[model samples]
Target: MKKADLEAYRQRLMLLRARLCGDVSALAKSALHGAAEQGGAASSMPIHMAELGSEAFEQEFNLSVMETEEDAISSIDAALRRIEEETFGTCTGCEGTIPKMRLNAIPYAPMCVRCAEQEEAH
Candidate 1:
Protein backbone atom coordinates (compact mmCIF):
# COMPACT_ATOMS: atom_id res chain seq x y z
CA MET A 1 0.00 0.00 0.00
CA LYS A 2 1.04 3.53 -0.65
CA LYS A 3 2.31 5.54 2.30
CA ALA A 4 -0.31 8.23 1.70
CA ASP A 5 -3.15 5.69 1.76
CA LEU A 6 -1.83 4.09 4.92
CA GLU A 7 -1.68 7.48 6.59
CA ALA A 8 -5.26 8.16 5.60
CA TYR A 9 -6.39 4.89 7.12
CA ARG A 10 -4.51 5.64 10.29
CA GLN A 11 -6.26 8.97 10.62
CA ARG A 12 -9.61 7.29 10.10
CA LEU A 13 -8.77 4.70 12.74
CA MET A 14 -7.92 7.44 15.19
CA LEU A 15 -11.26 9.10 14.57
CA LEU A 16 -13.07 5.80 15.07
CA ARG A 17 -11.23 5.19 18.33
CA ALA A 18 -12.21 8.58 19.65
CA ARG A 19 -15.85 8.04 18.82
CA LEU A 20 -15.84 4.58 20.43
CA CYS A 21 -14.25 5.94 23.56
CA GLY A 22 -16.93 8.60 23.84
CA ASP A 23 -19.66 5.99 23.48
CA VAL A 24 -18.04 3.81 26.14
CA SER A 25 -17.84 6.70 28.57
CA ALA A 26 -21.45 7.67 28.02
CA LEU A 27 -22.60 4.09 28.46
CA ALA A 28 -20.70 3.71 31.70
CA LYS A 29 -22.11 6.95 33.06
CA SER A 30 -25.65 5.91 32.20
CA ALA A 31 -25.20 2.50 33.81
CA LEU A 32 -23.84 4.11 36.97
CA HIS A 33 -26.78 6.48 37.14
CA GLY A 34 -29.16 3.54 36.90
CA ALA A 35 -27.35 1.74 39.69
CA ALA A 36 -27.30 4.81 41.88
CA GLU A 37 -31.03 5.25 41.54
CA GLN A 38 -31.71 1.63 42.37
CA GLY A 39 -29.33 1.55 45.32
CA GLY A 40 -30.59 4.74 46.90
CA ALA A 41 -31.68 4.33 50.59
CA ALA A 42 -35.19 5.66 49.92
CA SER A 43 -35.73 3.73 46.69
CA SER A 44 -37.98 0.68 46.63
CA MET A 45 -36.80 -1.94 44.15
CA PRO A 46 -40.17 -3.66 43.73
CA ILE A 47 -41.93 -0.37 42.98
CA HIS A 48 -39.36 0.54 40.34
CA MET A 49 -39.66 -2.73 38.41
CA ALA A 50 -40.47 -1.14 35.04
CA GLU A 51 -37.70 1.42 35.34
CA LEU A 52 -35.22 -1.28 36.36
CA GLY A 53 -36.17 -3.45 33.39
CA SER A 54 -35.68 -0.57 30.99
CA GLU A 55 -32.36 0.28 32.55
CA ALA A 56 -31.28 -3.34 32.23
CA PHE A 57 -32.23 -3.34 28.57
CA GLU A 58 -30.31 -0.16 27.95
CA GLN A 59 -27.28 -1.55 29.79
CA GLU A 60 -27.34 -4.76 27.77
CA PHE A 61 -27.46 -2.84 24.52
CA ASN A 62 -24.64 -0.57 25.59
CA LEU A 63 -22.51 -3.51 26.71
CA SER A 64 -22.98 -5.20 23.37
CA VAL A 65 -21.90 -2.07 21.51
CA MET A 66 -18.94 -1.62 23.85
CA GLU A 67 -17.76 -5.15 23.15
CA THR A 68 -17.98 -4.62 19.40
CA GLU A 69 -16.21 -1.28 19.66
CA GLU A 70 -13.40 -2.85 21.68
CA ASP A 71 -12.88 -5.51 19.03
CA ALA A 72 -12.74 -2.93 16.28
CA ILE A 73 -10.36 -0.79 18.29
CA SER A 74 -8.04 -3.79 18.81
CA SER A 75 -8.12 -4.64 15.11
CA ILE A 76 -7.30 -1.05 14.17
CA ASP A 77 -4.36 -1.06 16.58
CA ALA A 78 -3.10 -4.30 15.05
CA ALA A 79 -3.34 -2.79 11.59
CA LEU A 80 -1.29 0.17 12.74
CA ARG A 81 1.35 -2.23 14.08
CA ARG A 82 1.40 -4.05 10.75
CA ILE A 83 1.92 -0.75 8.97
CA GLU A 84 4.88 0.00 11.21
CA GLU A 85 6.34 -3.43 10.39
CA GLU A 86 5.80 -2.89 6.62
CA THR A 87 3.31 -5.76 6.45
CA PHE A 88 0.04 -3.86 6.44
CA GLY A 89 -1.37 -5.29 3.22
CA THR A 90 -0.42 -8.92 3.67
CA CYS A 91 -2.80 -11.62 4.79
CA THR A 92 -1.81 -13.20 8.13
CA GLY A 93 -3.49 -16.56 7.42
CA CYS A 94 -2.15 -17.23 3.91
CA GLU A 95 0.85 -14.93 3.49
CA GLY A 96 -0.83 -13.42 0.44
CA THR A 97 -1.09 -9.78 -0.55
CA ILE A 98 -4.51 -8.68 0.54
CA PRO A 99 -6.56 -7.05 -2.21
CA LYS A 100 -6.50 -3.28 -2.24
CA MET A 101 -10.27 -3.13 -2.44
CA ARG A 102 -10.64 -5.31 0.63
CA LEU A 103 -8.21 -3.12 2.53
CA ASN A 104 -10.16 -0.03 1.52
CA ALA A 105 -13.41 -1.63 2.57
CA ILE A 106 -12.04 -2.79 5.91
CA PRO A 107 -8.87 -1.02 6.95
CA TYR A 108 -8.34 -3.47 9.82
CA ALA A 109 -8.68 -6.68 7.79
CA PRO A 110 -5.84 -9.11 8.55
CA MET A 111 -6.62 -11.73 5.91
CA CYS A 112 -7.17 -11.81 2.16
CA VAL A 113 -10.60 -12.46 0.70
CA ARG A 114 -9.93 -16.11 -0.07
CA CYS A 115 -8.64 -16.93 3.40
CA ALA A 116 -11.48 -15.00 5.02
CA GLU A 117 -14.03 -16.94 3.00
CA GLN A 118 -12.39 -20.23 3.95
CA GLU A 119 -12.46 -19.35 7.60
CA GLU A 120 -16.11 -18.36 7.43
CA ALA A 121 -17.01 -21.64 5.72
CA HIS A 122 -15.37 -23.64 8.47
Candidate 2:
Protein backbone atom coordinates (compact mmCIF):
# COMPACT_ATOMS: atom_id res chain seq x y z
CA MET A 1 0.00 0.00 0.00
CA LYS A 2 1.01 3.60 -0.46
CA LYS A 3 2.25 5.69 2.46
CA ALA A 4 -0.93 7.75 2.32
CA ASP A 5 -3.08 4.65 2.56
CA LEU A 6 -1.12 3.44 5.56
CA GLU A 7 -1.61 6.79 7.28
CA ALA A 8 -5.33 6.63 6.55
CA TYR A 9 -5.54 3.14 8.02
CA ARG A 10 -3.68 4.35 11.06
CA GLN A 11 -6.27 7.05 11.61
CA ARG A 12 -9.05 4.52 11.23
CA LEU A 13 -7.38 2.18 13.70
CA MET A 14 -7.08 4.97 16.23
CA LEU A 15 -10.73 5.83 15.91
CA LEU A 16 -11.75 2.19 16.30
CA ARG A 17 -9.57 1.79 19.35
CA ALA A 18 -11.05 4.87 20.96
CA ARG A 19 -14.57 3.70 20.31
CA LEU A 20 -13.96 0.22 21.67
CA CYS A 21 -12.34 1.56 24.79
CA GLY A 22 -15.27 3.85 25.37
CA ASP A 23 -17.70 0.98 24.93
CA VAL A 24 -15.84 -1.29 27.34
CA SER A 25 -15.66 1.48 29.90
CA ALA A 26 -19.33 2.18 29.62
CA LEU A 27 -20.24 -1.48 29.94
CA ALA A 28 -18.03 -1.85 32.99
CA LYS A 29 -19.67 1.14 34.64
CA SER A 30 -23.11 -0.25 33.93
CA ALA A 31 -22.16 -3.63 35.36
CA LEU A 32 -20.78 -1.98 38.46
CA HIS A 33 -23.96 0.01 38.95
CA GLY A 34 -26.09 -3.08 38.63
CA ALA A 35 -23.94 -4.98 41.07
CA ALA A 36 -23.99 -2.12 43.55
CA GLU A 37 -27.76 -1.77 43.40
CA GLN A 38 -27.98 -5.43 44.37
CA GLY A 39 -26.33 -4.53 47.68
CA GLY A 40 -22.87 -6.12 47.37
CA ALA A 41 -21.48 -9.63 46.86
CA ALA A 42 -23.44 -11.09 49.75
CA SER A 43 -26.64 -10.37 47.89
CA SER A 44 -25.68 -11.97 44.59
CA MET A 45 -28.45 -14.59 44.97
CA PRO A 46 -31.47 -13.12 43.19
CA ILE A 47 -34.63 -13.03 45.27
CA HIS A 48 -36.81 -13.94 42.31
CA MET A 49 -36.52 -16.05 39.15
CA ALA A 50 -37.14 -12.98 36.97
CA GLU A 51 -34.44 -11.05 38.76
CA LEU A 52 -32.00 -13.94 38.23
CA GLY A 53 -32.82 -14.12 34.55
CA SER A 54 -32.38 -10.40 34.01
CA GLU A 55 -29.09 -10.25 35.89
CA ALA A 56 -27.77 -13.31 34.14
CA PHE A 57 -28.66 -11.90 30.74
CA GLU A 58 -27.10 -8.54 31.47
CA GLN A 59 -23.93 -10.09 32.87
CA GLU A 60 -23.55 -12.41 29.92
CA PHE A 61 -24.16 -9.60 27.45
CA ASN A 62 -21.68 -7.35 29.15
CA LEU A 63 -19.10 -10.14 29.23
CA SER A 64 -19.49 -10.68 25.51
CA VAL A 65 -19.19 -6.99 24.78
CA MET A 66 -16.14 -6.67 26.99
CA GLU A 67 -14.45 -9.57 25.27
CA THR A 68 -15.10 -8.08 21.84
CA GLU A 69 -13.88 -4.68 22.95
CA GLU A 70 -10.74 -6.18 24.41
CA ASP A 71 -9.97 -7.92 21.15
CA ALA A 72 -10.50 -4.70 19.20
CA ILE A 73 -8.25 -2.77 21.53
CA SER A 74 -5.50 -5.38 21.26
CA SER A 75 -5.76 -5.50 17.47
CA ILE A 76 -5.63 -1.71 17.18
CA ASP A 77 -2.61 -1.52 19.46
CA ALA A 78 -0.79 -4.17 17.45
CA ALA A 79 -1.63 -2.40 14.20
CA LEU A 80 -0.32 0.89 15.56
CA ARG A 81 2.93 -0.75 16.59
CA ARG A 82 3.25 -2.40 13.19
CA ILE A 83 2.65 0.92 11.50
CA GLU A 84 5.50 2.38 13.51
CA GLU A 85 7.77 -0.55 12.63
CA GLU A 86 6.74 -0.44 8.96
CA THR A 87 5.01 -3.79 9.02
CA PHE A 88 1.35 -2.87 9.10
CA GLY A 89 -0.91 -5.05 6.94
CA THR A 90 1.60 -7.89 6.95
CA CYS A 91 0.55 -11.21 8.38
CA THR A 92 2.19 -11.81 11.73
CA GLY A 93 1.95 -15.61 11.47
CA CYS A 94 3.26 -16.10 7.93
CA GLU A 95 4.71 -12.73 6.92
CA GLY A 96 2.40 -12.57 3.91
CA THR A 97 1.20 -9.34 2.41
CA ILE A 98 -2.36 -8.68 3.56
CA PRO A 99 -4.62 -7.60 0.72
CA LYS A 100 -5.56 -3.96 0.69
CA MET A 101 -9.23 -4.83 0.55
CA ARG A 102 -8.99 -6.88 3.73
CA LEU A 103 -6.96 -4.18 5.39
CA ASN A 104 -9.55 -1.62 4.41
CA ALA A 105 -12.29 -3.72 5.93
CA ILE A 106 -10.38 -4.44 9.12
CA PRO A 107 -7.71 -1.78 9.55
CA TYR A 108 -6.42 -3.39 12.73
CA ALA A 109 -5.90 -6.87 11.35
CA PRO A 110 -2.56 -8.46 12.17
CA MET A 111 -2.81 -11.48 9.89
CA CYS A 112 -3.95 -12.23 6.38
CA VAL A 113 -7.12 -14.24 5.91
CA ARG A 114 -5.35 -17.45 5.06
CA CYS A 115 -3.00 -17.22 7.98
CA ALA A 116 -5.82 -16.21 10.28
CA GLU A 117 -7.97 -19.16 9.27
CA GLN A 118 -5.04 -21.48 9.59
CA GLU A 119 -4.20 -20.14 12.99
CA GLU A 120 -7.74 -20.60 14.13
CA ALA A 121 -7.81 -24.13 12.84
CA HIS A 122 -4.96 -25.15 15.00
Candidate 3:
Protein backbone atom coordinates (compact mmCIF):
# COMPACT_ATOMS: atom_id res chain seq x y z
CA MET A 1 0.00 0.00 0.00
CA LYS A 2 1.07 3.59 -0.51
CA LYS A 3 2.45 5.50 2.47
CA ALA A 4 -0.41 8.01 2.38
CA ASP A 5 -2.99 5.23 2.31
CA LEU A 6 -1.32 3.54 5.22
CA GLU A 7 -1.39 6.72 7.25
CA ALA A 8 -5.04 7.26 6.45
CA TYR A 9 -5.94 3.75 7.50
CA ARG A 10 -4.00 4.26 10.71
CA GLN A 11 -6.01 7.37 11.46
CA ARG A 12 -9.31 5.66 10.71
CA LEU A 13 -8.37 2.71 12.86
CA MET A 14 -7.37 5.02 15.72
CA LEU A 15 -10.66 6.87 15.52
CA LEU A 16 -12.63 3.63 15.46
CA ARG A 17 -10.66 2.34 18.43
CA ALA A 18 -11.44 5.46 20.41
CA ARG A 19 -15.14 5.23 19.62
CA LEU A 20 -15.41 1.56 20.46
CA CYS A 21 -13.47 2.05 23.68
CA GLY A 22 -15.95 4.64 24.81
CA ASP A 23 -18.86 2.33 23.91
CA VAL A 24 -17.31 -0.59 25.79
CA SER A 25 -16.72 1.53 28.89
CA ALA A 26 -20.28 2.78 28.89
CA LEU A 27 -21.59 -0.73 28.35
CA ALA A 28 -19.53 -2.05 31.26
CA LYS A 29 -20.85 0.63 33.53
CA SER A 30 -24.44 -0.06 32.57
CA ALA A 31 -24.17 -3.83 32.53
CA LEU A 32 -22.23 -4.27 35.76
CA HIS A 33 -23.71 -1.50 37.85
CA GLY A 34 -27.45 -1.15 37.48
CA ALA A 35 -29.03 1.98 36.04
CA ALA A 36 -29.17 3.51 39.51
CA GLU A 37 -25.42 3.89 39.54
CA GLN A 38 -25.57 5.73 36.22
CA GLY A 39 -27.69 8.59 37.61
CA GLY A 40 -31.03 6.82 37.23
CA ALA A 41 -33.58 6.61 40.01
CA ALA A 42 -32.70 3.87 42.50
CA SER A 43 -34.99 1.03 41.59
CA SER A 44 -32.85 -1.91 42.53
CA MET A 45 -35.81 -3.91 43.72
CA PRO A 46 -38.38 -4.59 41.05
CA ILE A 47 -42.01 -4.52 42.14
CA HIS A 48 -42.83 -7.52 39.96
CA MET A 49 -40.97 -10.68 38.94
CA ALA A 50 -41.44 -9.94 35.21
CA GLU A 51 -39.71 -6.60 35.56
CA LEU A 52 -36.78 -8.30 37.26
CA GLY A 53 -36.55 -10.81 34.44
CA SER A 54 -36.62 -8.00 31.87
CA GLU A 55 -33.83 -6.20 33.66
CA ALA A 56 -31.73 -9.36 33.71
CA PHE A 57 -32.23 -9.84 30.00
CA GLU A 58 -31.28 -6.26 29.27
CA GLN A 59 -28.11 -6.58 31.30
CA GLU A 60 -27.18 -9.79 29.50
CA PHE A 61 -27.77 -8.18 26.11
CA ASN A 62 -25.57 -5.25 27.02
CA LEU A 63 -22.82 -7.60 28.16
CA SER A 64 -23.01 -9.50 24.88
CA VAL A 65 -22.73 -6.30 22.85
CA MET A 66 -19.88 -5.15 25.05
CA GLU A 67 -18.00 -8.37 24.39
CA THR A 68 -18.39 -7.89 20.65
CA GLU A 69 -17.12 -4.33 20.91
CA GLU A 70 -14.15 -5.49 22.95
CA ASP A 71 -13.32 -8.01 20.24
CA ALA A 72 -13.42 -5.24 17.64
CA ILE A 73 -11.08 -3.18 19.80
CA SER A 74 -8.62 -6.06 19.91
CA SER A 75 -8.77 -6.41 16.14
CA ILE A 76 -8.22 -2.67 15.73
CA ASP A 77 -5.20 -2.88 18.02
CA ALA A 78 -3.78 -5.68 15.91
CA ALA A 79 -4.35 -3.70 12.73
CA LEU A 80 -2.50 -0.71 14.22
CA ARG A 81 0.41 -2.94 15.16
CA ARG A 82 0.40 -4.33 11.65
CA ILE A 83 0.61 -0.78 10.31
CA GLU A 84 3.64 -0.05 12.47
CA GLU A 85 5.21 -3.32 11.29
CA GLU A 86 4.48 -2.34 7.65
CA THR A 87 2.01 -5.09 6.94
CA PHE A 88 -1.26 -3.20 6.65
CA GLY A 89 -3.80 -4.04 3.91
CA THR A 90 -2.58 -7.62 3.60
CA CYS A 91 -4.72 -10.57 4.50
CA THR A 92 -3.38 -12.48 7.48
CA GLY A 93 -5.02 -15.68 6.23
CA CYS A 94 -3.56 -15.58 2.68
CA GLU A 95 -1.16 -12.64 2.49
CA GLY A 96 -3.22 -11.29 -0.41
CA THR A 97 -3.92 -7.63 -0.94
CA ILE A 98 -7.27 -6.66 0.58
CA PRO A 99 -9.21 -4.42 -1.76
CA LYS A 100 -9.51 -0.74 -0.98
CA MET A 101 -13.31 -0.98 -0.79
CA ARG A 102 -13.17 -3.57 1.95
CA LEU A 103 -10.54 -1.62 3.81
CA ASN A 104 -12.60 1.51 3.53
CA ALA A 105 -15.63 -0.28 4.92
CA ILE A 106 -13.72 -2.11 7.61
CA PRO A 107 -10.32 -0.63 8.36
CA TYR A 108 -9.41 -3.40 10.75
CA ALA A 109 -10.35 -6.34 8.55
CA PRO A 110 -7.48 -8.82 8.52
CA MET A 111 -8.70 -10.99 5.65
CA CYS A 112 -9.83 -10.64 2.07
CA VAL A 113 -13.39 -11.32 0.98
CA ARG A 114 -12.62 -14.75 -0.40
CA CYS A 115 -10.69 -15.88 2.63
CA ALA A 116 -13.31 -14.43 4.96
CA GLU A 117 -16.10 -16.23 3.13
CA GLN A 118 -14.16 -19.47 3.17
CA GLU A 119 -13.54 -19.16 6.87
CA GLU A 120 -17.22 -18.52 7.43
CA ALA A 121 -18.14 -21.59 5.41
CA HIS A 122 -15.97 -23.75 7.58
Which sections of candidate 1 miss by over 4 Å?
Answer: 41-48
Better of 1 and 2 by lDDT: 2
Note the Cα lDDT for every prediction shown: 0.84, 0.87, 0.90
Q: Write the per-residue lDDT of candidate 3 for residues 1-122, one digit (tens) a residue.
A: 99999999999999999999999999988776875643555555677889878888998899899999999999999999999999999999999999999999999999999999999999
CA shift of 68, model 3, Å: 0.1
| TM-score, cand. 3 vs. native | 0.90
TM-score leader: 3
Question: Between prediction 2 and prediction 3, which has the larger TM-score?
Answer: 3
- Output the number of the lDDT-best candidate: 3
TM-scores, one per candidate? 0.84, 0.88, 0.90
Instruction: Supply candidate 3's per-residue lDDT for 93.
Output: 92
Least accurate 10 contiguous residues by lDDT in model 1? 40-49
lDDT value for model 3: 0.90
- In candidate 3, position 107 carries an lDDT of 94
Model 2 Cα displacement at 16 (Å)? 0.6
Q: Write the per-residue lDDT of candidate 1 for residues 4-120, one digit (tens) a residue.
A: 978887887778778878887887788777678768767445466787688789878877887888888889889889988989889999998998888878988999988999999
